[model samples]
Target chain A: MAPVGFRSVEVALQAGGPRRTKASCHTLMEPGMFIYTETPEIQKLRKNIVELVLTDHPLDCLTCEVNGNCELQDTAARVGIRKVRYPDGENHLDREKDLSHPYPHFRPVEMHPVLPLCAGLR
Target chain B: MGTPLRVVVDEMGGGFREPVKALHIGGPLGGLVPMSKIDDLSIDFESFASNGFLLGHASILSVPERFPLVKYLEHLFAFTAHESCGKCFPCRIGSVRGKELLQKAQSENYQIDRELWNDLLETLEKGSLCALGGGIPLPVKNAMQYFSEELKPYFSRG
Candidate 1:
């Protein structure tokens, strides 16, 4: 049975605004090769990368502490990024902390819980 | 448009164990919330930094806070990092300094949180670049503003 007054999330979202959304940090890396331009090349690469990382690939780690509790998967699905340039075993990253402070020193950078991805990596 | 956007939890590069666990240490605001904790929240610039945190596909997952000080400042950090005008000094130098101060506050110097942070924050607040740098102090400052007594342990105890 439906809730007392529940038509659909889409309806609720529409009431508010755009319910269709996603968590996309697109760099808009348009071949900075020039001064301005999203060059078809860069866009393609971006789309490819997006697809690869998102597919069946794990959004949160296998046993991540934030598992179902994670926002990454939700955002990714919203963005519809099911493909990338490569696969899970492809791109290398800033897996370790680049720098540290005297008190709360950190090693692995990509580790989200330690800090936000913005402070750690691209 | 409505409320804050969907939360963004990053299990960076297999960093966490699958079927992740949740832990909220920020007292009530941060205990350990699961996905079920969040429904569909509509977030726009209010929750976005526009610069630092929202670079490409990277996003921040927010835990609801009874007191918005820490959470909001947490949002500002990345924004300052991203929107930094690099125009004058404070925004540029101050934002960097703000990061340092945050590091200090979160440090082990439990004996000198006040004296240390007060000075550190004063500098960043006064000399930062855009509001980005200048604003970073709000979270910690506001925390101290309202919770200064709670934070006195770092100073008076010393």
Candidate 2:
């Protein structure tokens, strides 16, 4: 999949013959074009981006329900984010969980034992 | 575009009688030009860029000398946080974090960690999907650059 914040293009042509323009990860490479995938600048930017997201996120990975099965955890590991540099500030972690939905189907499967009977009835 | 900024403020806008500390040229996300540098700048994109500022929208909001620049910076952050579309994380969360930092500094005299501050700005600049997030750092950076003395108390000791 194309990286987030990057445009996905199947085919791009330089119809105007290459005037000055900004390039991103999806920009089509031309002959003799050189691309730097993991430069110091790129690494720093990637790390910083992940750190920013983690700054506001709760750091309760060890005790969280999805400890072993989380995409953010996987991405953080891949990016090598050993620590989040941002200081503790306003965050949504402490907000009361919204359990207001009336649908029991939205709850965990174990909590709704009659779900199987309903499915079989259907 | 070559017209002097002073002309824009004084001649066209009918100059203020009271002392003005800085001019927030352009809209809310625009860079702040301290009173000291107002005369030297011209109403152009390159001029603002060279001076570590931005001429976005070219609208001016004059800040009086009595007003605290930190408060102005806080307002900018608050505006961004409220206006963000919530599609992307960097802008959605970063703006709120920025606002919180400023609020703490204002209310509790908190000393912000400079490294963390820089990291937050960098993330917003590089990771955001659009200008709303990317361009915010320009004005904040301008204030930090031009009005460092005013903002000194808010930053932690190195």
Candidate 3:
């Protein structure tokens, strides 16, 4: 139940620690803590972020290459996202896909599993 | 008190009880049971939840026959939205969305995506982080289950 979103809220431990933290979620977490309460507020805030991001996102979940593997989709599912209320608000229709980015790309791995170990080290 | 009296009866347990079309026990998170089951209920958590009702604060709300369950649901959703902590996604956004959805049903000649709304409710119920988000669906489901005939008029195709 460690706050899900915040990674940057850092607590300097006397020992080793995680490299970087997502602040919103990390602020509520401690270095040595393995389990934290995922408060209702955190769930709501995270869900709101996803909803806001999805406003401009394309509605092509079915045809998209990422499809089931997409992080957004996964987050949405975790938050039980069923319907996007902002269908007419904004869309990604104008953004063209660019493949120019190189490999070894930045990926955000969920810190839940490793967080305890990192905190334990601290 | 053990005798099941109809809602129309004015006397109960030596107290004058007002006639109500429906009774809402356990506040907004609670279910609206038909008047027939009012006397049959026990003030216990297991019994209340087993009946799809909340064993919440034990607040009782009575609605007259003329009031619409859909309208009550809209107000309940709005109330929950205002009371939300502005945290977790499902409760924060879903409360507002739920209120809006119920409001949309109020307009004349509207087409509602019933399945979509149901799915939205399911998400909010399962995904929300707290009771505020998880409990909002109770009354709506109660209305759907017990009073669909009354709510049907609000959902006609545009």
List per-prediction Cα lDDT, in the order shown: 0.36, 0.72, 0.60
Higher-TM-score candidate among 1 and 3? 3
Ranking by DockQ: 2, 3, 1
lDDT tens digits, residues B52-80, model 2?
A: 77898898888998889889888888999
Please state the Cα-based DockQ of model 1 relative to the true two-chain complex: 0.01
Winning model by DockQ:
2
DockQ for model 3? 0.08
Highest-scoring model, TM-score: 2
Considering summed lDDT, which 10 consecutive residues are worst modelled in model 3 chain A?
A: A103-112
User: How far does residue B155 in candidate 2 sit from its true spot (Å)?
Assistant: 0.3
Residues A1-122, candidate 2: write the lDDT tens digits. Answer: 23323311122235455432222442546765445545565666666666666776778889878787766677678778999765677665665444444432221211122322333333
Fnat for each model: 0.00, 0.49, 0.03
**Complex DockQ per candidate:** 0.01, 0.28, 0.08
| TM-score, per-candidate, Cα-based | 0.28, 0.77, 0.58
lDDT per residue as tens, model 1, B1-158: 44433323332233334443222222221212233432422334323333112112223333343433333444455457567654333344334433444444445452434443454454444433234555556445534544455445544333
Model 2, residue B139: C-alpha shift (Å): 1.0
